[model samples]
Target chain A: MTKKKQPEPAETGATEHQLWEVFTQPGGGKPFEHAGSVHAPDAEMALQNARDVYARRGEAVNLWVVPSSAIVASTPEDIGPFFDPGNDKPYRHPQFYKVPRGIKV
Target chain B: MLGHRLSEWCGHGPILEEDIALTNIALDLVGEANLLLGRAATAENAGRDADALAFLRDVREYRNALIVELPKGDFGFTVARQFLFSVYALHQWEALSTSADDDLAGIAAKALKETRYHVRHSAEWLVRLGDGTDESHGRVQDALDELWRFTGELFLTDDVEQALVKQKLAVDSSSLFDAWKRDVTDVISRATLRMPGDVYMQRGGRSGMHTEHLGVMLAEMQVLPRTYPGAKW
Candidate 1:
């Protein structure tokens, strides 16, 4: 098990401040999409940074910022087993099914 | 002039995010100035447009406060100035949003939204800088102290504005002081900085009197237009 990384104390003057992963919503009840990352001392600053960095030019109607350390990403070593595809299953694809004329995707 | 000062941070901010943030603010201010200038031109009833008024103005003719005309000292200074000015501007806009005049009210209503965001951004920076480290705290506190005197000018109601205020055409600048002070005190206390008390307030920017810096800035800002009148791309 990977150890959960702790965020640094903001006022201690860390060399590299905490990294925040940015997600932005494009409005109209759309899901938030990963935009980019920004460096900030804490959550409030992270949100402001995300607004300045990612929300310009009408790119976002909403923004979300998460500490990069809080995210647990899979390693390349686990690629084979974690997302293994034992065989091609053509029937599992939604496109394989034929629908009546009145049906819509 | 504040917009001009903010524009200096276009490529010179400490971080990429700040660079964009400052420049975005600069653009917003400049746009606001453009609209205000257009409104002024119509009010003047002269044949001048916004460009004419901006490019043709002399040093003493420009009625902007001294704080904005001062050079962009440092990031701390810029943030401090933004906080002070944005707060005042926000209140002014809020009051003016309901003015009897349709044009001024419409402009103020739109500007209120932008000013609100500007206040939020600057206030956030003020807290971070004032509480972050010993060096940052010292610098930002110094900035706040230096900017404190200039804030009085924001509440000064000139004769023209007072007359307009009577007719409900302009906001009563003096009336906004208490609310502005309360908000400023709250933010300063939260930032853990002492608010400088009762310094000699600077004044006289509204009557066409300004600092020496405005001339140099105007020279730079108006050179092209002055040289080639009616020149266009």
Candidate 2:
């Protein structure tokens, strides 16, 4: 919900209008998970394309189509600083402390 | 049938996303036909099943509207035909959802959901193509112009539908024209396209009289069933 689309990414080709990242909620109360992607001119078509490409045969009860440009993913340059710092510290994992039963850390 | 015609676009849509989308709608329509024809067979109290009615019968015995039988001319034409038919079908299904016949009402209820999506999908494409660049705009307009004549047959009601209407067993398709027109007019205008004028409206799919194209299509569709008896899909 927080992601906002960035405009005029040069990679968008002549025939391509936009690329959308599809997310699906498997059931009520479930979190939306990244499903796949589709190319459409706008959000309306993106949503429908998600349904057509992913929702056939009752795959999901709900759908969300986010513009791929909206997502801010970590680049390769950030791999060492963003991820490696966490791996050296085992106490960051919940197993180091008393945890509620059935709770996933 | 329109379903078969739509299915032909399975691997041939202009874009990959659209290709999958169009074929999904085609499958929905094909499923609708299977259910409707199965019910028709039961209603007739004849030994014939859906397979026999669909594969064994000649084109002359078909009762579908002429618009569905015409060739899928282009991407624009396909979307235009879907928009035209889905709007009408939505209305018809709405009326049928309250039918006195329980089975038909159930089928209508299920079909109504599918039809809503069909209407949305086609209407979106129509707007995109019609309001698009010169080439897209011109092509869609031409397609719409060519398909306008076939719209009249969709609302035609004969004695079969009339008898069922009186008994609350069928929808009065003729009565649905006004709403269809209103909805279609709004979408066409929104698409930045002019409505085709009242030219000569083609009719007669109800009587099984079709253009020369149907026979050719039927040959391809029915060949397997006609040659290899008792073939199952």
Candidate 3:
């Protein structure tokens, strides 16, 4: 199978600093969505950078900026084994439980 | 004046999405103004709540940045104002998020997100209009020229900002000017729009001074409350 393309890292020989991941909640009741990334001098500047980059259309109510360096991401190769055990736990499946008629999932 | 003008679109935007978007930004700005004005009221011992400070106050009592009061000439102008202000606000909120005042910092932390989208939406439109048809380009450029005069007021610092800066409750507004310019210019240039050249800058939004438009806006916005006198929706 063809491998999924990965996001490229920051280019080398660039004078500007690193990128920051910006997550946002559209409103108080919404979950945060990864809006996009921005580059800036530091965490404080990163938040500003992300604000300048992401939240333009009433699409966010909250913002969280984490340095690209601070994040610990799992690679695709690690996903199968790391998540495999839980897949075989049939008891964890909702299908085993009986539901009342007309009940929605 | 701009906030009120934009707020006029509260229930009247062309589409629901645009409606929500415009109102949301208006509320964000009005909310921010409320906070600042409330603080100013307290400092001045004006004995007014935020609503009173916002609705009951006359034009001469408002201290909003002039850029926030200018008429929203058209969608392009509105977007231009939103674009510039959002960039400025994003930087302001980011800095304020770490302010010494916990309340102010917390508010900033929350507001930064809203302001972020305001910037993005405006920027997106700026790109579309700037790089779209010749008519679109021309009007957007016209909007920029008309709006540029008010921008200087955004970065102008006075006693309040100075005192707040000393108290660590505010950012030095001037410090963000370069970033604001770079951010706005980059977007304008990419959109193929010309930035207005050396122009006479309008001042006086921060000293309870205002444009004639504010009186009319306040009249309409405050009429319901003034007429009903405590009637609830």
Q: Could you tell me the TM-score of candidate 2?
A: 0.92
- Give the per-residue lDDT digits (tens) of candidate 1, residues B8-92: 8888998888888898889889888888899999999889898888789898888888888888888999999999999999999
The runs of at least 3 residues in candidate 2 whose Cα sits more than 4 Å from the true structure, single-residue gaps closed, are A1-13, A98-105
lDDT per residue as tens, model 2, A1-105: 112233343645455768999998889889988999999989999999999998887778999999998999999999999999889898998767888899886
Measured against the true structure, the TM-scores of the candidates, in listed sequence, are: 0.91, 0.92, 0.67
Model 3, B51-71: lDDT tens digits are: 777677778877778787776
Backbone clash count for every predicted candidate, in the order shown = 0, 0, 10
**Residue pairs with backbone atoms closer than 3 Å in model 3 (clashes):** A55-B116, A55-B117, A56-B117, A56-B118, A56-B120, A56-B121, A57-B117, B1-B69, B2-B68, B2-B69
Off by over 4 Å in 3: A1-105, B1-3, B35-46
What are the per-residue Cα lDDT tens digits for candidate 3 across A66-90?
Answer: 8878889889998899989888898
> Which tens-of-lDDT digit does each residue in B23-133 have in candidate 2?
888888888889999999998888998888888888898878889999998898999999999999999999999999999999999999999999999999999888776
Task: Chain A only: give the TM-score of model 2.
Answer: 0.75
Task: Single out the weakest 10-residue window by summed lDDT for candidate 1 chain B.
Answer: B129-138
Sort by TM-score, top down from the best: 2, 1, 3
The local distance difference test score of each candidate is 0.87, 0.89, 0.78
